[model samples]
Target chain A: MRIGKRSSKLMMNLYQRNKFKIRATTSNPRQGLLVATFLILVVIGADVFMDGAIRSRIRPMLVPVASFGRSAVAAVAGQDFWSSRQALLNENESLRERIEKMEAQNAGFEALRDDYEALQKMMAVTDEEGEKGLIAPIASSFRASPYGTFIIGAGFTKGVREGDIVLSEGGFVLGAVSEVNAKSSLVRMVFAPGQKTEVVSGSTGFTISGRGGGNASAEVPREAALAEGAPVRASIYEGRPIGIIGNIESASSSAYAEIHVVFPINLNTVRYVYIVPGNE
Target chain B: MSNMRLLLAILGIVFVFIAPPWLTAMCILALSLRWRAWEVLLIGACADILWFPGTFSYGIPVVTLFSLVVLIILEPLRNELLVDRRMI
Candidate 1:
């Protein structure tokens, strides 16, 4: 009789286990969804409630991952590595052509610079020794940041500090350092949304309102002598350029012409940046 | 979960760090269509955490805000269209 009772109990336990598994798998997704929704809301609230301490700690931990991703992207963009010989050969050929084109462009730019210098001399503008700093490799994708910021591999250990000016290879202002970690620093673009910079295109001076995503716009009097491809400069950087005029929108009746300025180099293809270290 | 869905979900997080914002948004939207993948919120939060830099300075974080919007928008469709009519 005892042996019979034991066998019956085992059968009961097996049935209950199977029923539990069924219930668990087919459980209402709505409950899970609602819970997740609540949890995410709570996370956001905590982020705000705690004064962003939640993000401050969590973000720094992601530096290694961001660094790795940036390295991978840079390598892919340059097409510098491949296991296949055919792929390597193709990359070599493309790089050679690219170098030739760049060399010609560089020569043309030199002549333009000479002409610009002569014009500046004629105008009696004084030459000044501009700010200089170290060149740092960009450690994050430029467009990935929703905040109009990007990461650079150099940081405090490398003399990078907050408010350092970030520039493209061509010496156009790109951004300034906003946050610095030991090995990486975050740079907020000059044209970040809600920011404005005073720039001069020819003799006309105006404020360019940042539209984010690497562009800014300004409005000048229709007769300000603004034209497409005109270089824009800010007096704060001495003679270094900020960006170039991209598109101009004006009509015969309008009193103001809309001028769009953009970085000469595509931010995505940029791999390295020159930093002019900040005071604090 | 199927392999493609799993891969897409994983890539969604990685792309937040390296891919363009629009592409990351697409990845998040695609995953939200299939499952109420709460990972969407995670990836969104990831972006805000990585790039936001400071508190409320740049306004409310857009990536996280957009991810939340994506998940909420797709919830009803997932419930209506899945083969099982609810989730497995």
Candidate 2:
């Protein structure tokens, strides 16, 4: 009884001390509004002058915390989930067939790579020196943002410079490093809203505009011959395939063809991206 | 009630990084209905830094703006619903 009374007295005293300050701010709604406006202006001013230095410093620290929370949630969700023996057997058989197809595809890619290297050596082309790549796991994803972007686990300390090309497995273009801090970096994907890139459609050149949500579209002249599943290569990356045309629609009112493009790899499932240096 | 508000504010900040954007926004809105939670703006700024690409010119910080709007809209509701119970 005494302990409970003492704790309640302590709480009452603490509340009494802060009561006036809280009322002074909340009683007059106009004062509260002014305070909020001033704070927002301060944030905007900081963003403008600091050049994102404040953000770079603070965001990297949260990467590990966010990753831990994600892992914990996944673990809790997986704990009660189970599969039957027949289901597991079926899944195992499917994986074996998939592995066989992947091996065949890998052999074909190795042969192509060998031929390309031989041609490069025969031509004596050594202008572009190859640089090592840093593999970084994704710390946070774009799904959390109102806009489409993601954070990677590597940054300036790991030699991840801005403008470095981020690629998924098989050299598929994911994005470029936009901001780098000490321990993490932000990647701006090719399909982020308002992001524009110069891409060549097979042989035809056009500028594609990002429509956000891993989708992009470009307008081509009516006379240009383009089809679904055509390769779209980034001009800045030496014609490297960035996306493929998913569909084509003829604008009846305008003299143009609307081409919809999509990235080959799913952004959500991508765990790690290869950060190729010297591409900036 | 105040203790609940404080707990919600902390959770809101944590959810900015771990949970979805809507949950974070809901927490901020709830806090604003009770007290002047300026931390919402800071949380929004952190969200922008973590997910937004600094290089992009067009993308604006939506969370901060949304928090400001909620605070403004909730001001009248707070005045009507909350009772002044503390003694000077």
Candidate 3:
């Protein structure tokens, strides 16, 4: 009993020696917020103080953990939990998703076909015309970055380079490669927050700025005829529809109306993305 | 470590990779209030390092920077708010 009390006192003494005073009866000190701040400082210090040597050295080890986290999430999603009703609901949801994906992809292919035909009549064909780009598995969390960026499993070794256009499974424009590493690359979303792209809404052309999380918004003259669910096509994405118009807001005092656009596919469900060589 | 702090720390780490940014931020915030949870910064750093594009990219290490700022801001506030409990 005495030993236990003495050890408790000793432990109490140890905690009391820190810089920040905690309200212990014996006057122990606070350790401060250590977990997030300490590691964050280490990462920042590695970048600023050590020229990123520590992060570069330690990143490879952490990659697997990130991958495992992704896989674990996938596995959990794939589970049925022994509930037949839930399973059926999931199946029905997936089927509806597949149909929407197919319809959107078909529309994209028809647009591409028309564009190709027009180009064929205008100029000689290049060698890379029909070459399909590489598919890379998503390595990091889409929810992880505040900058609307994500990492792909394939990188420099897989022929991925900066400025490569990334595409969804249904050929929707996703983003472009911003950074390439040995076995991983970073993709900055076309609809990244504050990013801009020229898009056509019906017959009207205007600039849309990304609001992040697979959404964007643009202002059009209140006199223009536009509707919700109309596809917005961007020239940078090979004239493909980048997103569909979602919501419209107009005020009596405003000259222009606001339209919020949404990327058709939910980024969370995407497991892989295709990388295409960007045109110079 | 206090059991509450330990559990909060574990959740903060787990949420960084799987949960939404807001959710993870909330978890970290809850953690910072209970204990001087430095581990939240590590989780934030790990997240920033993994997702942040290299020096060539346009992204800011937002998680780390935000957590640092939060910790700094909450330090005095927590001390003052929890003064009654500190008497124990």
Candidate 4:
């Protein structure tokens, strides 16, 4: 259906009026707020999605940012660690000096005690082992497989040899050298497997075999007059207390009396040992 | 179009595929140079779809419809803001 010219002119005027109204409404505050909110939401979503894509290449640009944060934290922590290390070193040095002083005093006391023991053993007058002799200091340790041994400072260089029994500075029977090198020899401790000896407690004077006992104590016959807190000496060429009896086993036909002796010296911790090279 | 604007638009499209971030500043610049907003945005969306085909291809119709609606709202305000800043 065709409209007349007058009607067509009226419709065109109305269309133009609507267009102008639309343009004017676009600038209203309400419309501006809606547009601004929509732009913000779109930009945020777009940025979130785009950030992932850009990050693959933008990593370098972000490095200085992350490093700035890390370095600040590290600087604070590093200062604390440096000060703590300095304080620790000062305490360690002071303790070391104190330890050295104590060790020197201990050496002098050890010498005097050894002399007193020698004099006591001398006056006993039983005289079963032989003449007493001064024990010399051990110099070095020997390490080998299947057989653990140590070397003394005094060897054939000072007339020590194979088959000679070595003693600790306290006159404890440690071991005898199974093999000898020029300046050092291998000492097999008496408690080593396959080694045995006769031992006597104080004045009991009965011979007991030195079957190997581990780091724990040894078990001896309970009714055989052994008691707690008694010194046990080994009878091998000379009498020396290698271990002390700590406890006696409960009396039962099934068990030998057991005692825990603190090893006369810590075998693993010993830095120096002695060898008594006698008239050989 | 002048050689400089055409070169810039081409460079802008290539970089959008190579790296989509190149589109944002470029679109703002293209608008500043008096290029039609639709032309700049159409070019940008097309280049963007090349890199992210899964999201933008099947997704293009939606984005296009949305972008046109946004462009219609934004064109007048952007024009006013730029004019206010003496950038026009």
lDDT agreement of model 1 with the native: 0.77
Model 3, span A1-280: residue lDDT tens = 9999999999888877542333542344343434435545655866866545555555666667777888777656645445687656776777869976996787678657755553442222122334657767788777766667777888789899888888775567788887677787778887888889999978989899997899898899988888899888888777866788898999989999999989988888776676778863
Summing lDDT over every window of 10 consecutive residues in candidate 4 chain A, give the lowest-scoring window. Answer: A140-149
- Residue-wise C-alpha lDDT for candidate 1, range A149-235, written one tens digit per residue: 888888889888878877776667888888777778888888887678887888888999887877999888888888899999986
Q: In model 3, what lDDT does residue A19 have?
A: 27
Question: What's each prediction's TM-score?
Answer: 0.73, 0.68, 0.72, 0.36
Better of 3 and 4 by lDDT: 3
State which candidate has the highest TM-score: 1
Candidate 1 stretches with Cα past 4 Å from truth are A1-28, A80-132, A235-240, A278-280, B86-88
RMSD of each: 8.7, 9.7, 9.3, 32.6
Model 1 scores a TM of 0.73
Put down candidate 2 lDDT per residue, A8-56, tens digits, no spaces.
9999998986886576654754465577679776866687677766667
> Which stretches in model 2 have alpha-carbon errors above 4 Å?
A1-40, A73-131, A251-254, B1-11, B19-36, B55-59, B73-88
Per-residue lDDT tens digits for candidate 2, residues B1-88, read 3677678878887787767677888888877777666666666766776676674364667777788788778767776776342411
Leading candidate by lDDT: 1
Candidate 3 Cα outliers beyond 4 Å, as residue runs:
A1-42, A45-59, A82-129, B56-59, B83-88
Lowest lDDT sum, 10 consecutive residues, model 3 chain A, at A121-130
Please rank every candidate by DockQ, starting with the best. Answer: 1, 3, 2, 4
lDDT of 3 at B56: 23
Best model number under DockQ: 1
